[model samples]
Target: MRESPIDDFWVRARAAVPTLPAAVPEAWAFGATATDADALLSLVLDGTKTGTASSLHDCEADGDALPEPGQLSVILDGSDLPRAVIMTTAVEIVPFDQVSAEHAYSEGEGDRTLGAWRAIHESFWREYSQDPRGFSADMPIVCERF
Candidate 1:
């Protein structure tokens, strides 16, 4: 089988950061579409974005483990190529409506306000959530800081 790009990226990353774990960590893009992924990745690379949020229902539906502090991740760009590595600095679960303004600012999206974050994330989850329940104001959100 052909070697995956993530594997190659992991090898180089480990070589550069010898303190990294021996095993490869999870790799994923930011948003549902390629454009979104690339845009979000740029924010991360520029130090503008430091946090992200996800749907708890979607995580459970997908059988993905919840992120924990100190867990490393490989962030992928639009083309599914690894671009940067990040470590989870914190994780909090809260209702969509209760997400903090500080968290929203850390997300580094439009206006970096809670209102914009809610609007953007609500629209995103409504259309792209993996959970059958889709979007709801009371839905649990996984707020993560990297």
Candidate 2:
């Protein structure tokens, strides 16, 4: 079996900014997918994207867990190299249909509008899922802002 990749990002990060919390990062992950991950990480590094939303159904489907406020997460690029670390500042669970415009703007996707985010995310979820029902208005979404 191939061993997982590892690096000294944590050590270097600590040296670069001494005031960061002492708590170790709780998770390491790339974005939702290769292309999306790279794009989103760019947004993050450029200080444009401050928040993200994900379908709770999708998380369950993928057997991944939700993130919580105060948890530090290492964001990685498409190549799986750690690039930046963000401490989740807030987390909320809301229905897909109920997502607010402010939250969508923080996502920094196409046009940075709620409608655009909805259209894009709806298409993404439908394509991402194997379930016959696909994306639904009432589906619970994890709205996380960091």
Candidate 3:
């Protein structure tokens, strides 16, 4: 398999942070697209956004695996360069409607409210899928905290 952009970063990071394990990272991304990825990565670097969510079905559809706790991943910037390394501290699979206000707050996006998070995330998920049925309140979401 082809190495991801994150692989290059992992090599550099391990060199810089000698304490980091030598094992390869599981995955890495810039969070969303250009603008969104920059923003989210900033939040993570500044210790603002500690939580994120994704559509479980979307991952399955894309053949991308969901993250598991204890896995280490790199956070990338808009140019697909590494900005930070994050270790998954927790993972919760829940329906969209079951997402709590606390989780929304941790995302550090919009007004930091459940309504804002829901609106933003739902819109992203909907547009992310070509199918109209991509997003729904009952959709299973993977809520990850690091």
Candidate 4:
């Protein structure tokens, strides 16, 4: 089985994340022909898992250091699906951390809100809301447009 680019990226990002308590080894593959942005997040929200190969538009930043606006990384374990893909991107972590701290006893989307996790995802919800460049004590990021 071949590893997807996203998978490869994560192998590297993992080093930065450090070993945490809750970590799920994930892999993703990218098709340059794949659509741009965290469009994958929308697909997942609609309960879609199958991904299509499309032209990949480069994000605003460059290099593996992570872009200011943030770059989307991915992983792919080509064990079964030839088009296997997974995407991970940046989001507001501080607000999420705060919400999690106060609402240890809450319900609903709070279970997976923007401030709920640093889990694997690609949506720049901040682009649509007021949480642009939001950061946590662990992950600090500059606020730039995607």
Candidate 1 TM-score, true structure as reference: 0.96
Candidate 2 per-residue C-alpha lDDT over 1-146 given as tens digits, one digit per residue, 9 for 90 to 100 = 54333337766777888986665575454346878789989999999999988788777877777998887787888777888999889999999999999999999999999999999889888887645567999988899999
Cα displacement (Å) at residue 107, model 3: 0.8
Q: TM-score, each model? A: 0.96, 0.86, 0.87, 0.21
Model 1: per-residue Cα lDDT over 7-37, one tens digit each: 9999899899899998999999999999999
Give the worst 10-residue stretch by lDDT in candidate 1.
1-10
Which numbered prediction scores highest in lDDT against the true structure? 1
**lDDT at 22, model 1:** 85
Candidate closer to the true structure by lDDT (higher is better), 1 or 3: 1
Best by TM-score: 1
Compared with the true structure, what per-residue lDDT tens digits does model 4 show for residues 1-146? 89664455455566666542233343343322234223443444344432221101222222223222223323332232222223333223223323342222211222444354333212333232234333233333322111
Residue 71 C-alpha lDDT in model 3: 80
lDDT against the true structure, each candidate: 0.97, 0.82, 0.84, 0.32
lDDT of 1 at 121: 98
User: By TM-score, is 1 or 3 better?
Assistant: 1
92, model 1: CA deviation in Å? 0.4
Query: After TM-score superposition, what is the CA distance of residue 51 in candidate 3 from its true location, in Å?
Result: 0.8
Clashes per candidate (backbone, < 3 Å): 0, 0, 0, 17
RMSD of each: 1.1, 3.0, 2.8, 16.0
